[model samples]
Target: MSTIQRPSRPCKECQRRKLRCDAQQPKCGLCQRARVPCEASPAGKRGPKRGHLDALRNRLVQLEETLQNRLDSEQHPQEHAQALHYSPGSTDASQSTDFLRGDVGYGDPLPQAFMLPGPSMAGDADTLGLGPFPFPDLAVSLPQIDRGTHAELDQLYFDRVHPSFPILHKRRYLNWSKSTAKSRSQTCLQQVMWILATLLSTQSRDLINPLYSRVKQDIDLIIMDTGPCQLELVQAWTLLTVCELMRALYGQAWASAGRMFRLLQGLRYHEIDSPRKDPVASEGMIDPIRTEEKRRVFWMAFLIDHLLSIRNRWPICTRLPISDHAFQAAQLGSSTFLSQAVTEPPSSDTCSFNECIIIATLSGRGLLRDVHGTISEAYGGSGQIHIDHDEWLNLVLATRNQALRQRNDSDRMGTFAQILGQVTEILFCKSLMTMNKNSSTESCTQEYRCRVLRAAEKIVLFAADLTALHFSMVHPFMFIPLFVTAEFLYENRALGDGAFLTQLRSLVDVFGQLTNVNDHERSYLDLLSRSCQQNIAIMPATTCVELKRIARDFLEALEDPNDPTKAQAVASADLSVTHESYPSTEGLEQFLSGWAKAKQFMPNFRMELVDMVAEVDASGSGGKVWVFSKVTGGGGGTDRDSIDMMSINGEGKVWKTKDVQRITSKH
Candidate 1:
């Protein structure tokens, strides 16, 4: 075939560089000269399709028509007053404009996207910024620390603390007052001091010993001076009461710490006089002590609730090693009113620590269960509705029976869902505390953890907003659902930690409930419906894929019968080949499956696969590696703790590559 000689097309600069050109402006000439991948458009190419252009034009015309109609109505004195009643639909505002210009899209809007909810509502005192607030510099006015003071105290404390369940520390910036202003420095120091103190309080709660009592007493004395202490006192009191019940159940000393915790809980939400007549004020609101307080509470609640699950013999973890049977028996046999304790009339001698324990325990357990469900569903599924049809039917039956029983006993008391919701705040607060400070670069090994946290914070806010809505609507019926969602969100926060996308979806789902309520305010209902629909529609496709992968992992884990190491190894390799370290719960499960698969062929097989790693070295160069291996697996057999793989590894041992393991013999 004879080739027709066509004129070569090259932009001026590309011709100078003697380079083949895609022949485009802006990016063509310089990029071609640099031998870079030229992103310049090919000559004579048109931009995005004309359909988009036509759509834009139609939208503009429609908006213009509406505006013109509004202006025309305004300009005529005869119709000016009537214009107020003229709805857009009556004026020729096309439905397409409403549909096309629905609301803000999925991706973050530049600048405004980053602007935060606080700045958007800057005029309001109640609002706080979504991101970490910048700590103002005030150190110049502060007194210098003495040489004796261990300046590394803060860092040391963080190190000694149990690696917070999630690896990353919530981001918090340093705010020190200047030498000239010792007062501000003192204030900031006090805040940090309280935060650290509260964290230590939860740690102490777990100690469950005589030393714990003395330590808590002394700690209480110190924290009582801080602003958030009053609430902390309630938590402390609750912990102490629970401890006392434990002791009392075993015939130990009748410690009166229960009264202190009760007094504190009762003190919360009590209204205070304010010079500003802000109608929104409820009680002297519990200003978060340190950002971590709520998180600590959630974690504590999570632990306690799991304990309750074992106690109640909840079927979910029945296969796991826990004293579920013994717990259930004890619960049934106990006559000291453990279940009904909190509601019982308090005696003069003691407020019945048993009641506080039961109530707190119930609250904690509810939060944990809900959170587990949320995280499990979020991190390990295909966006499928988690409702087990059978489970829902059972729940309906149980709730109906309980509702009837409560009606027969005391009409004033809440329904089962309401009680669940009320107790959930305890867990939710903890989740908030843990997540409120997410500014660190710590590798998230659990994908769902971050997702859960993000969803939780948003959900909590959504619930709070909905609660306000219910109160505004003057509908008592809405409270139970609100509480249920709040509790669910609270647990979600604790479990997900800071998984932003997952958490946002969770919140959207709960907000969806408000939209369904007929009594909800029309404006709020509209905003919620639109926001939720938009969020769901625009959620990134990658997230859906990740969610599905996570779900698949969970399903595989649950279904696989063989606990063999070989089988697990095969599964792990299949799941985690793409990432070195497990980026999420799903990834971890995949690794566990790999280990199980490996054991099938090599009974003694044990392996660890760490992915998405960043190790800081002395010279600051960072390197990462991934491995699939076969090795010995040995440990104290129990599900309560993770295997100490580091301790188990022999010094100088290296894993060599081998044939990929498969979960089944057929493979």
Candidate 2:
């Protein structure tokens, strides 16, 4: 008969004494029989139970398999590593192991017998272990353990609590450990230092050392040198990017460092033209190549330091220092370097350098408006004297060309786009100021207004064309200046109102083109629209109707073929260029619809006729013409009337006793 396996019977003590007893426990009937006291013990408590035993067995089997595979690999050392696609997310164990073994493709496999040194381990090296590298200064020091002993938990109150986020202290240490490696922490520290350094340092060049040191450290962490050409190229590229970042930060600190902006460009020449003094190579090492790489990193930091100084624009002590002749000269030098970047074959080194220059230019523009009031006060009356249409065109063309032609070098091209915006803003502002000042001056003449108008028109048209051509890349930086110019032109009743409306209409029609691209053109377009609405809201209620009509008609024009040429005719031809266009029956209520609601809260709002006589009268005696609004009983009348338009003629008082001359309005 077949034997049937049944559950084990209860211990003999349970049968004889009528007490239940488990066979596997601290004590059972089997133990009692030996005169031992009985005690209960939980299952799987004393040692490895079934579950743990199974896990251990599996681990041992895996180890055995791994050992066998390793042995096979050692015997057949010539075996090639498997190449697999790497997704940023999912990774398998074999792939991970291969990565740890440095099995990444090295093209023409290195000899297996050659053993490269790794980060040091205990016993084989000193307390501060030395690597195989020759340069002691370049060697990175590991984070040190605190030397202090008997540290109380109270001392860690500050350590446990993050100053930026105190609530973080409530979480356990293990909970926050996963986030300690965040790049944001590094960025935050750098930003704090950057702001402090810019504010504290009186001399632009004085901040260079600290900036360069940080940049060098960053490069050391990111750059990996495995070969001669590849190492040199990457190092060069890193240096160039550092230079660009430094340059971007330069004009913000001090104007004096404007001269130093050229230093990075010159330094590039030094690094590239220097004699190729090859270092001695050691077996199983890339020491010689690494030395060159370090030099490249050092030079990059040096370049970045000066560039940052220039960006801060501290020396010039003016907003948008780019307008200064000296600043412009420095800009020209920067542009020269950027223009030179594209003509050469771009390696990793070349690409980064190009990027650096572009970023510097963009960053420098941020400092422009800081000096706006000073520039306006100093050169406000200079009118058409400062207009340079050709120069403006050149800057526009250069930037647009750089952005398009050097698409691969975005950092540099992006910087160029920013510089273009700055230069354009300065010109646009100067033109707007002239138009505002010349509005009422009979001596100013239509010829002068028209001349200024012509310049504004050309800039707007050029910007519009450039916007379409490189919308994906150039739009973000292009928007502010372009829209600012558009607003200014619209206020002056200049040529571009028609053109801008037309271009905008075309853009709206083909809006789909701006989508699905890497560029952030939509942000710029939105900024422009918002800005336009704000400026439009401040116009007289009568003009509101015509403005709305123009806006609506332009939007309507989008329904037509999105050809810019056709849109221009439709939008431009619709705007009434004559004085009759003013005082449209459409009131402020309709116009504000296109504007942001926050603008309605403005304390003062006025829209007056553009007059020329008032400007000449005020400007002739070194006074400023101010526009005023009057409330009429019949219809709300908004007209230009100058008040307090005289300067104190070497006197401390308001000087109201002078002859009050009234300039008649011809309109």
Candidate 3:
């Protein structure tokens, strides 16, 4: 520990710490006292190299020249592009904005999962330390939205995709994303929940396509993974099926649904319906909530299977895992079996996922099942099968009752439950009538005919209930069945009562006011509407109301034959005469042609007549009419006009354009 004369150069340790080194022979005094080895460098060993100043000057000179060149180019687009070097692995401008932002520094490679459906980092996989990046790949940058944004999506989902539909579990899924687990299946689930939320969100437009595409890629990887089945993956694919169905991608939805169902079977989700644990199965130790999730997912898939079958008019791919009418109260017997099928027991009276599944199952099996059957019974299956009329009626009634029961409960399910039931009965009668094309009224099922006519009126009232609400956000189940109801009403207009054509006309107008958020059944909507209008043009329509009900400064005519009929009598001060809203024969043909183009773009739109006078004599001659207003849905404000209409017994015959003339009218 002697303090000798200081060495010219300090020991490496002293130099590193900028401390004085004692420079003793064995070791620096400081190093020796610290019991550490130290090596002192020779003088000037680490000094600047000879001519370093000159090299520094030269480097500065080079930088000055480069700056001068850049300035001389003035950052021309092409010149700037050549000057700024991009990372070799950088891709098109479409890289995610909310994720993976900024330059990808060297060695900071994209995770194998994110790079999927795209190339990876610049070098060979081994060189970059990723090594083929492994299938059932780990670490994709699954959604990393801020808590606020994530929360908003959760709200969006619960708000729009009602829990009663049962595609996903809210609390479980949101918690899973926040979990520390980064397994491949976890990534798939996280990505799909993100996509579902994005698809449901109104403000997240840009995120949908990217999220959708990436989730699909993640799903493909999960399906190919050799590891054990993951419940989360099944759940992800269930939500994915919904996404596809929402976009009307039926083929993709079907294929995805099949894969998901197979995965569900692989995981033995079908057997999990019972609460008892199986001794030999790994699932014996599964979290109780997870078991509940499996059931929810199974029911969700069951519903999807029935939906696909109904939409396609084909047999259900999932088959009848349980009885089609397994919903019978006496059979199920106070079990609340469907109640346990969800994570939470349904919130009291609101229809649960089980309710939805039962209705879909019954509709698919009864009315639409072998839908081509007629007279003796041939609703479908190309008439190869036969059932007794009493048996057939029983089936229809069971489905009808179940559906009506859904409607009777709180509509917390969003779409009206009554819609499904009424439409089923309506379509049931429609099928019988359609199949019995050659049969007389006596040969057809009278009860079914009556049901069809009643439903035609009932479905309109059901839809009318949707006014003033955000119709676009409602489920497709609402519009799809409503569309079916409209078509049925149109075809059976002849069998309708006094108000039948008016009701038929009212239902037909729904085809226009109702804006299907998703482009579902797009192919047939327009054509069905045109045919209904053409028929209404030829069929007789009589609307009777007291004149006191007609409001001032409004014209209610046959214009906008597509707008949901607002045949409601307007409540006004004057009680002069009765009112009727009818179209001018002179304008009906022209109105038909321009319906789509002239129609207002309103999502929750409906139209109601405000003021009018029906002055036609019992002789049914054309007459002059006066002013009225029509209250509209969705697109705000009223359509006020003055019109004089003319008509006759135009039923069952095409009206020539010259048959009626436009009388004097003022707006």
In angstroms, give how far residue 519 of model 3 lies from its true place: 8.9
- Whole-model lDDT, model 1: 0.32
Better of 1 and 3 by TM-score: 3
On residues 1-667, what C-alpha lDDT tens digit does candidate 3 reach at each position?
6755556777866663334465778776777875767776555446754565666677567667655654555544454433232343664444343124533321132332232232332334333232122232223222335567667766766666644345444555666666676777777666666566565443555556667777776677555333455677777888888777666566788788877765654444554534443435534244534545556677677767765563433222221122212321112212245323222323333344455665565566555444444433433335533557536555645544554554464443434556676666665555565555566766466666766677667778766656433433555445456655655555655564544556755654444344444432122233343333344332232222111112111223234345423211221112122123323323333434344444545444444332344443353322223333333442334332323332222121112212122222234
By lDDT, the candidates rank as 3, 2, 1
TM-score on alpha carbons, each prediction: 0.19, 0.26, 0.51
Locate the minimum summed-lDDT window of 10 residues in model 1: 645-654
Candidate 1 vs candidate 3: the lDDT winner is 3
Candidate 1 at 210: error in angstroms? 11
List runs of model 2 lying over 4 Å from the truth: 1-311, 314-475, 494-523, 529-667
lDDT for predicted candidate 3 compared with the true structure: 0.48
The lDDT per prediction is 0.32, 0.33, 0.48
Q: Indicate whether candidate 2 or candidate 3 has the larger TM-score.
A: 3
Q: On lDDT, who's better, 1 or 2?
A: 2
Report the C-alpha displacement of residue 155, candidate 3, in angstroms.
2.6
Question: Backbone collision count in every prediction?
Answer: 71, 46, 22
